[model samples]
Target: MEMNSSNLWVFIETNEKGQAHNVGLELLNPGHSLSRAQGDEVVAIVIGQHTEAAVASAEAYGSDRIIIVEGEEYARYSTDAFAYAFHALITKYAPTSILIGATDLGRDLAPRLACRLKTGLTADCTELDFDEESGNIAWTRPAFGGNLMARILCPNHRPQIGTVRPAVFKKPEQDTSHKAEIVREEIHFSIENIRTKLIEEILDADNETIDLEGAEIIVSGGRGVGGPDGFKVIQQLADALGGTVGASRVAVDSGWISSAHQVGQTGKTVRPRIYIACGISGAIQHLAAMSSSDTIIAINTDPEAPIFKIADYGIVGDLFKVIPEFIALIDEQILTMAV
Candidate 1:
């Protein structure tokens, strides 16, 4: 590895269906800015089986160069195989910087690859910037339990690596007209050397996965919701508006809702078109994750609630009463349209 390369590689992770993850495509949005500042090409690296679909998306999502490795062993994510294959590719390319999504597979694979390459790895970054003078990446992430933001730099290391949180940046507009240089590589690892094997996969029946990040409208509750039964009221409004249900850390901690629905510094970050905060007091950690929403509507009894400060519309009333009225209004509109 010469370490003089002028390319920024974004790892485009693929699922079993060979679909490119949104986080990878989203990272490309930032990749362009970073690469521009560094005066390097933005390259997309796709490793999966039958990756034609993923490759096409990478091209449409604004990758200057696409590197793909297709093999049967990559149909399902294996930490061993992915780490080994990625290690090989990094050695061959020697890219100046690599950005990976902080997904389950990426979290498992990044540190291992960093160890093998003997480089620094930054995890769960919420912001990214390049210092042209120092030729270093300034990775900004939450520190001290989301109370403070820390900017870290790895100056001496070559091929700076970082895993950024999903939805921290929006995906760029798709341009199918643009085409990128595609490079296909054949890299394989021994199946026998893999330490783990997929025996049986069990799905959680109690929890339904929510795409809160992709939702246009989200209705979230906090400690003010009272208890588990209060979420039922939140769900009714969410259902009426065709929105997704979200929760603050307090709600999740109180066992009022599953952790899958949590939104905050420790939980999933979302940027929906409209975010409604119900009975939430707006702690800094909660506000940090959702302040970027396009339109914020808050419903709380206390006029002094911090959430009211950032809300586009703040209703100082009991959510239990305000929500039902909102739902009834939506229902009436639907009935009138049907009539």
Candidate 2:
């Protein structure tokens, strides 16, 4: 396969419903910058059954070119099928760089594809930029248990591969006025070659559906919450405000909540419209994850808590009392609006 140094491919991972993941579109925001830096074109690769939705989204979001492969075997994600399809595409059109979302399925498929292509892959990249000197993609991620940051460069690799974290970058605004070149490749994977089988899909119980990344408002608690019982108040406030629950590393470590609710450099990074921190002292790692929120409200007993420094509105008091007052005010406002 001949390497094409003029193309940067963004892998758009789609679900069984053919809906493209947000991270794929989010990468396009950075992809355009990378392409501009090296004078390259951004190409979106979509592989799935009934890929009309994904293709339309890629086209709407802005891609210089779109390569699509549709087949029944791709309806549900299997490592073998996806890897085989991606391998075939990469072999046919060797791109300079490949960006994939660091999702559960993506984490499984990227290494396999990278190994087949015999290239280096950087995972959980928080930052990506084009290096002018080496002409390599600079992939940045937290290293050493989130204590430090590492910048990786695959200068020797033909097509640099990386898995970017979700919500690290915002999705670009839709530009229906722009159109991209669409290329549909007919590549079928034999049933025998696909070693994996999809078992019965079991949905997550009610507790596991915390969507902090897509949340408009997040109410978080930390060590000041005391214990699991303290989270009840936090949940009450979040429920009253119709928001999701978030926690610092300490709260997760203490078993007050699930790790899925944890927010920090080591956990998930979030940027919501409004973030309410209750009893949170705000460590640097925690702040780094959510400091980009549009509005931050911090409530703590200590006036000098670090969280107050960045909070848009700071309340130095006990969260237990403050939160109830907030719920009352919201309820009153809703009632007034109804009247």
Candidate 3:
């Protein structure tokens, strides 16, 4: 493969309806920052049918150029098909670095592409930076069960690859006025080359909703919440704050709440403006998800809870007493504002 130009490449993920995911925009913020610092263009690679909307959305979020691969196989996410398409692009236009979201599809495809190109890939990265002097990328991720941060460097690889967890970075401000060049590429391989067969995809009717990953405010609970009845107080608090309710893994595992509301390394990573951890002990896994929150409030009986370390506000008291009083205060404040 001959390289004509070296730029940063970001893999944009689209939903079933061909709409771009929020994480795709989130990557653009850091991607554009790196591109500006390194004097390289940020090229987004979007694979799917009818991806012009996706491209436009990518451009709105600071993509300098967009490479679109359109085909039926590209519509449905297949690990082999996506890897082949991405590999083809890598061969055609060699990039300085490749970034992908640490979603289910990205987790499956990035490693395969790395293996095919014989390049090093850092997974679940929390931070990325380029060494100006050496022009090498430094990928930072949590290691040893999230106890320590490890910075990885791939000195020999042409395109340093990394996968970042969702919500780890802020979404770039939309620049609709910024124009971007769109490049369309055809999928050379046929259905025969694609070994995997697509079975029927079953989507739950109730599963279609806004996820907490992109939510601005999240009110979460933990084991100190007591039981299912305790969730009422959390719900009231969330309603007062105009935010969604989330739960720690302990709360979910104990049947205090559904797993969908769980926030942790094993659940979902959320970067919100406010993350209130009510009656929750902060485990390393739990911290992995909401540590990126702008403001964290920890309200628990134990003053020594680990969550207080990262919390912007630490309230040492029973949540049962704290929540109602907090809600009343907020209500009164709202009423005063109305006056």
Candidate 4:
């Protein structure tokens, strides 16, 4: 492994509009920890046109250095162009490792750069640590149907790389007090070398309707809900509490709900203020996603359900019987508060 700079690099993912994604900032926390132990600086790489907001976010999130790659060709995400720029940077600096958010954009970019640089890339890592003894990163992720966790390593590779899932790690509180050295670099590659072109972008119609990632309270239903109609009860309880509805993989697989609402190892990861699991059996895959939630309430008929073990409060009852009562009690409480 030939090395030059020993700094850790984080890819700050941005949309075509140059809006910074939260996962990029979230990664800085682990990056800070790994860098501290590895005796290296944390570098945030902001790519695309008009990246001032991205740069500011990285600095506020505690990056020690900023590398900005801005070009007209980068205004849109053409894999060929972006990959070329990333490869150029890696060759120039030879950073010890690169961390990318496992976002849609990052999922696309990390592998391309890794292939170009001839290095290993781990995807969807839930945890990252610096092995003090081995002087390498231990990237931990769920494996084998989420029955077990696997910690992976790429000892022989320089610029070790991994893509971490969104919300797998908490976002560090922004400290505007922190600052970073800004390095502006130009992507000298020709746009003609790019094989792909961005023609039109059609945004998701349900983007405004769903926000499980930012939802404060989530009421999740699972296999015990019985059928599609079961979700209505879950929704009613969520509405009563001013929360959003979530679903287990079983519910989604049954075609009872949209995949957007699924929360587990295979779905979107979330850490909410309060999580209510109704009828959920709490598989390890499901627990891996929501275990970090501040408060968990499990309502199920089976006392032996795995969810009860981790729940802050467990209710042994049928969800159909329990939810309506909760809605009624909540409504009564609201009326009492108003009075």
Global lDDT of each candidate: 0.90, 0.90, 0.88, 0.89
Candidate 3 local Cα displacement, residue 181, angstroms: 1.0
What is the per-residue lDDT of model 3 for residues 1-339, given as tens digits with 9 covering 90 to 100? 233377999999998888888778889988988888888889999998678778889999888889999998777788878898999999889898999999888899999999999999999999888777777788999987689999889989878899999999988888899888888888655767778887777764534553788677899999999999999999899989989899999998998877778898888899899999999999998998899899999998998899999999989999999999999999999999999
Candidate 3 clashes between residue pairs 3 or more apart in a chain or in different chains = none
Model 4: lDDT equals 0.89
Query: Which regions of candidate 4 fall more than 4 Å away from where they truly are?
Result: 1-4, 198-202, 335-339
Per-residue lDDT tens digits for candidate 1, residues 1-339, read: 233377999999987789998899999999999999978889999998889998999999999999898888888888898998888888888898999998888899899999998999998898999876798989998877667888989899888999998888999999999899988889997777788998998765544458887889999999889999999999999998889999999999988998889899778888899999999999988988888899999999999999998899989999999999999999999999999
lDDT of 4 at 183: 90
Per-residue lDDT tens digits of candidate 2, residues 1-339?
333457999999887679998899999999999988998889999999899999899999999899999898888888988899999998888888999998888899999999998999999888898788888999998776556889999988778999988888999999988899988899999866789776687664644488898899999999999999999999999999889999999999998888889898777788899999999999988987888889999999999999999999989999989989989999999999999
| Candidate 2, residue 295: how far the Cα is off, in Å | 3.3
Ranking by lDDT: 1, 2, 4, 3
Evaluated at residue 332, the lDDT of candidate 2 is: 99
Worst 10 residues of 1 by lDDT: 202-211
Q: Residue pairs in steric clash, candidate 4?
A: none
TM-score of 1: 0.91
TM-score of candidate 3 on Cα atoms, chains taken together:
0.95
> What C-alpha lDDT does candidate 1 achieve relative to the native structure?
0.90
lDDT (Cα, 0-100) at 78 in candidate 2: 87
